[model samples]
Target: MTTGSATLSAATRRSVLLLSFATFASMAAQRICDAMLPELSRTFSVSLAQAAQVVSVFAVVYGLAQLFYGPLGDRRSKFGIVTFATLSCCAGSLMSAFAVSLDMLVLARVMVALGAAAIIPLSMAWIGDTVAYELRQETLARVGLGTTLGIVCGQLVGGLLSDTLGWRWAFGLMTLLFGVVGSLLFIDRRRQQAERLPTTNTEPVVRPGFVAQALIIITGPWSRIVLGVAFVEGAAGFGVLAIWASHLHQALGLSLSAAGAIVALFGLGGMLYMVVARQLIRRLGEQGLTLLGGSLMGLSALVLGFTPHWLLSLPACLLAGFGFFMFHNTMQTNATQMAPKARGTGVSLFASALFMGQSVGVLLAAGLVDRIGSGAVIALGGGVLVSIGIFFARALRRREELMRLQ
Candidate 1:
């Protein structure tokens, strides 16, 4: 290989790695907050519903902020945007550590969520610019692993630290990590800029029609169906875990730590799907995989709903987790392919749908748990997922036929 080409490749690899780490670490903060909420609620003498606002506010702000970040990445420097976002996360984490009231804590979580939300879109966009389409899934798979592993680590670490040292220390340590990592990345970026030559008359690599691209993904050919599946799939997987610790504690007499571990196992299923999804995609195609994933999620939810046994529910959780990711990944992968011109906006729109689904899922589950029961609420989610999948299958078939005609 040529020396300059090899150097460029190495630089790109390093950048992707740094961004991936930043993304994983930022996301870890999200779930860890869940573990801390109960403690905060007790300290502030707030109801569980009131304390849950911490997560609710974070999810909403995080999803909404992506709309801004996608355009920022297109207009400004990605490295600068990432560094700035990480700084915000660091500030939020430190502030939350010292928060004296539930209101202050919820505000702090919003800061962290807003800061961390920028990482994924920027990283994925950066990767899209660097990698070819054919090999993108392998790279995406690697990034997906980072996200899922972060979920697992967040649960395990949040519970363990909250149990051993106290919840405040979790936020404190996260603040330290964010501060250190953000500083290091900023320094590295400066060093790279100093060493590299400035190019003259460079054109914008990302297209200007990012908003249109976002709309297309949000409202395109069978886009609603695809996004609907993404939402339901996200709700079934993310919604359950978001509320499950309390549900298990109330229904089956599980401790928070034990529940966290069980949730960690469920996350492992997603990690496993990330590891093997490329092969599955190659063999099944997107539609087939979505159907298979949706069906499994439906079956798992049904099992969890009807069985009432923890052991049985465990495997059901695993299947549901795996199915959730498989289906969600299909939509995201397709979205990325859909608008290569505005990849950041496209993927961000996809994330917006998924997160929106999650917010609704958690809120809906929380409300329904008292009236319909956890089992029935989850079964309802599973039913929605299955219906979305069936619809998606038909839509994909029509798209394929149109492609043949074209």
Candidate 2:
């Protein structure tokens, strides 16, 4: 509820930095298949939507696994759980590199998703515990920068590696990245135990069961609002973006690698937003950010979807990324505060809502792409996101009055 940054130790700062890297790797693994979807389709002699099980299925497994990780984080050591989880991804990535069939690849991704499910949400929960509300948004932004950059690099790596060295090489890179980051995390945990350094987390003395904690969070009106918005955001925003590279490849006759490189600009735009997040947070406030951010993204999506010129797409994707993150970061800040008493469970529930939406969005968008065309599906997603933004902004405007009444 207040600033406790003064109590933040140097080791914790190091931990945050390490966690940032972990988040980067986690996010990178998620999007690493985006640009490779087309390549996988060709390799396995399947349809685009079928090849997309790599992304959609991973999301399903990832979202569901959060239910397990949420309560485990509350009862055990978050950092320790994260360390083990991170290491576990290495095995999955390695398996993916050797996958002989589409189904095998999907199974490998499930293994990776099972590990990666904990990385981002628990990292946020850990920050909520250690960093007070006053500093939470800024700290979360630091972690977010890693996340955004991962998006950039993931698209690039997936595209470039799949095109040149072979699609398996992308997973090879993940195997290495996860191995290294996970090891660093393990070492940090060991150091903390060795020196008996204090961390901010203390297990709740009278903590309820996971079901009760979840009920407490889901029962709150504002918490429900935040979760609902997250679901829609995942569906309309992140889920549909998965197809942008494929759309460009098929629609514009661009190489899959080139299309991916262009789409990677979206993440670069998010990195730019992170650089200026403090200014935006202070100037626009949450309501202004949501309204304006959604509008910008909607317009940009319309441009990116419709523009025939590949040159125009660069800026379109960039602006879309910037605006989407502006909206998303605000949602993240609110989620962190939604049920601070059960921060891990609350954040995981929020994540579940999000990735579940992602799974639905991918299936729907992919299914619709063949009928209406990818561009139309994309434009529709953009429109839905705009409506979500407007509704959320209005809800944010009334948040204070609503909270007081509650």
Candidate 3:
């Protein structure tokens, strides 16, 4: 597609919306297990720690699966891969709802994660293919509404389903959602294939070998830097956020549901950014947004770390959410362009680095939280995030200058 300021075609808009819904389902599946750990423990007569393996296993599988999907997306139809993945998610969710043991549940979750892995990064690659760089950020922000809402709703929906209907019903609901969305996307894919087959004006397809594409992304200095920063950003930023609910409950005696609601405010803040994305880009640009985002996140972390009352977490979470998306969205825009020839592989590696970073950060936090306390750990994360923002902002400036010179 050509880069232009023209309005998005109706079909493109529909595809984005459908992909957004698919993303929502995927994200919701990721978090739904968090609120249901106690239930899982009870159902299987296992320790809470043992039950937590469901979440851990899913994350590991999800992160690793991105490596396969990234190169496959480059060679196959991006939409086709995403649709098949969604069907896999639906099957996995159904299996989870009927799992007979903790081991079975864990296996089912791994299947779900395997499928969920492809939706976001590949959808992002699709956006990169169809949208212009200048307009891509806004398009991404708009699409982010689905993801943000999914994050916000996941805990609530999971908790509610677990409490009222039973945790199994939660998975059943997801199974239904995945089935519906997957069917719609499958139909859309058929339509796209039909439209393209008759066209003599179809664009030439690039089929770079998987190993070659991977090498292209890994060998580039700029791409390596982008991936590295994404890894650290995930670790330092999301790692702290991960423990917020536990900290609130342990430190301030807030109920689990209340603490989760406070964390959901972070998603609300992201939604706020999407509403004003166009104007924000015009006013702040990428570098300014990065600086502002990091500062806000650092401030929010400090606030959360030291707050005497639980209410303070409300605004703190909001600031952190807004800051995260500003910084993250900027990184995402850069990742899409880092290796335009191998955009899918580049973005997939970026995502893999990010998830791996989150896993590392969580491990580190788990080790330190007992000794230093959650408050100190969060404060440290804030400091690191600020440093990252500063470094990346300067790097982006240098990158822009180099491009202009070229």
Candidate 4:
């Protein structure tokens, strides 16, 4: 149980690689609807908010389902659960492709959410069980390259397919993606079992039921702060993000494909952060990351919201993406270390708070879009995120001092 990647086994590395791909597909499925929101609205003859149910409902189900997965991953094989979940997503994606009505599509999306719910957090917990804290952030960033890329790819593909082939084609792509990734993971699992490798490690379980484990996580003051910040991060960051493409499409008069491409830069920026994350983590420290990441994203978001010059969007979106990952990567590191005794429960609880906030944010933002307009809403989200950064930075300081006293 070395904590450093330098001593990490080859089998563990391979497992992490496969888990990364699974995460990519899971996240891509979640965001595939971003560019398709307008097209779905037009196709179904519904309002923007109604069309957004595809994203919001998925978040709702995705968040709540984490409760089931926390204990499950802790007890069983996390990788095994992830493999099954990835395969399950194919069924849902196929259903989404063939969805005959809006309700049907929402239901189909719920199916997808049920499966996707197990991927990212459990993968992180699995990593937490393996990688030591010294290099965990960098390793997670490497794995998160897939997640961040999925953000861009999902939007890019959704917009591109919706514009060219049709919206249905987007789901078709996800079906193919899930099937391929799941099969690969299944093969890897079999190989690991056959070889009797020790790469697939699990944490030593504490004697508690899921409810008690969850209570242990939620009752900690530091855990409460991480969960709280995560909730706001979900709402203000990812939740309000559902509208960016629509805003560019509607207000800026860009095509959905074009708008999604620009928004894809946000993920691209995130990828950039992932690429350089190790360096930044060494340089800035977590507090600096939180404060600066939030400021950069907030200012960049304001530019995207207010600037009539669409060209400015190129840099604004890129910087915004970079800044977001800076903060987000820091958050991920803290989450993994939050509850060592019940790492699975702690990380899953963090994920639950995040997407639940996303659910609430999407619902609230979508409603306000009609009244205050998308720009105002987006800018408002940016401002809130700045405050979040500041609050979390101070909290980090307080936590460090408390650790010293202890």
Q: What is each predicted model's overall lDDT from 0 to 1? A: 0.70, 0.90, 0.79, 0.89
Q: Give TM-scores for every candidate, taking all chains together and pairing residue i with residue i.
A: 0.86, 0.96, 0.91, 0.96
lDDT of 2 by residue, 98-175 (tens): 999999999999999999999999999888877777667777888899899899999989999988999999999999
Ranking by lDDT: 2, 4, 3, 1
Stronger candidate by lDDT (1 vs 2):
2
Candidate 3 segments whose C-alpha is farther than 4 A from its true place:
37-51, 162-164, 197-206, 400-406
lDDT of 3 by residue, 308-390 (tens): 99889999988888988888888888887776666678788888887777767766765677789988888889888898999
Candidate 2 local lDDT, residue 405: 44
lDDT of 1 by residue, 313-369 (tens): 678767876886777666665655545556667666666667777777777777787
Q: Which segments of model 4 are wrong by more than 4 Å?
A: 1-7, 195-204, 400-406
Q: Give the winner by lDDT.
A: 2
Worst 10 residues of 4 by lDDT: 196-205
Clashes of each: 0, 0, 0, 1
Question: Which lDDT value does model 4 have at 371?
Answer: 91
| lDDT score for residue 212 of model 2 | 95
How do the residues 1-406 of candidate 4 rate in per-residue lDDT, one tens digit apiece? 3444456677877988898898899889888898889999989999989999999999999999999998888878888899999999999999999998999999999999999999999999888877878878888998899998999999999999999999999999899999999999999989877876553234464769988888877877788889999999999999988888888888889998999999999999999999889889999999999999999989988988887967888898899989998998899988987777677778899999999999999999999998998988989999999999999999998886544332
